[model samples]
Target: MSGNDILVTDGLSKRFGDFSAVSDVSLRIQRGTIHALIGPNGAGKTTCFNMLTKFIAPSSGRITFNDRDITAMRPADVARLGLVRSFQISAVFPHLTALENVRIALQRKRGDSFDFWRSKSALEPLNLRALELLDSVGLTSFAYSKAGEISYGRKRALEFATTLAVEPEMMLLDEPMAGMGHEDIDRIAELIRHVSANRTILMVEHNLQVVANLSHRITVLTRGRVLAEGDYRTVSENDEVREAYMGAGHA
Candidate 1:
């Protein structure tokens, strides 16, 4: 792998019993770039994510991050190495205030996450950082509101803020635009652009327009393997991608 690569996978494969979910997939994501993974439903995109994030062990393959082998690392260990994944489903704590959720994530990053006896004020630095992250994601106005009280789109933004508090070097975002209205989608896209300026982002998205607008490169998967990889225009115009999308009625 080259020095500029932040995430690399070689011959990555995953299986469940007799079923192969992802097969012989090799990917390289450059540092400080936004890369999109696009595929039809049941095409193993989420399975690939599970393998990458260590949520599930890959049946076979090698994964390297920053030139270090990480194929067998635990999820938490991978996270501590500045690799973080935001789930497709919302993950914010509904009962907690947005600021509190971000503060909790900040505390986790500071290694004091389990120190329950410490007063909230004792971690004033974490609170400050959390506020800064919330501001960055445009959630400062709703900082004190319960996460559940925020609009669905704003809740997603809060989740992004929480992820930012972890200070990840590479971020894995699963459908950040899922369930969003046009205005919310525009706002989130801008936030993603701002975040991608400093950190590498690998996103799994179904919205081709958003993918085209945000990604520096696009990787298209079909049935368990890469069918095409290139810029939006290149992939969209590729025969294999066109066929895959047409077969799935999503072209």
Candidate 2:
């Protein structure tokens, strides 16, 4: 860990039987910036993400977040330290309204018991914060709607709101624009930019245009190893990157 990096990985590796999913991957994510990890399909992008979120343990390496070694930390422990991963659509409770969902996240952040259901006054204090979170993600219109009833884009915005409820110092977003239309993508991009003003964000996204536009720094991965790391123009113009993308049929 250095003065510049909020997150650092040293010689991270993951293996499954004869297959090596990630090999000697190291990354430095600067404080209060949007950093993106991108690669063609089968480039071990997802595996690397899993490791960082502590969803899967790395076979060998160290992961330091905010100057603490989290290589052996559990996912819940990692989250408690203010490093949180955005949940998938399925992770949200279908029966709960968007406000209720964000309220639940706020409750968890306060380390309160799930017994908020018992006392109306107990959760009243969280309502204001939850509404603020919903507004931040542009989901204020859907605040009272069921999370499952919203459009795909709206559901994602609600999820971002719920993630924000946790007040993470750094957030890990997985493909925030994966299934959005152009308008939805644009909206979500702006939401991300707004929230990132005070915190660091690292995301794994396939949307090259989104990454190019939003990321302050980018790390390109190929064959389970880092192929390049720099600004979009520098990485995009690299001959090796062009060849790799072309070979992968993604150019």
Which candidate number has the best lDDT?
A: 1
Per-model TM-score on C-alpha atoms? 0.95, 0.94
Off by over 4 Å in 2: 88-90, 112-117, 246-251
Which residue pairs clash within candidate 2?
none
What digit string (tens of lDDT, one per residue) describes model 2 on residues 99-174? 9999988988557585745866778889899999988887888888999898888788788888888889999988
- Tens digit of per-residue lDDT, candidate 1, span 181-239: 88988988998998887899999987677788889999988888999999999988887
Candidate 1's displacement at residue 164, Å, is 0.9
Q: Which ten residues in a row have the lowest lDDT in candidate 2?
A: 85-94
lDDT of 2 at 134: 89
Candidate 2 lDDT (Cα, whole model)? Answer: 0.87
Q: lDDT for model 1, on a 0 to 1 scale?
A: 0.89
lDDT of 1 at 161: 91
lDDT at 185, model 1: 89
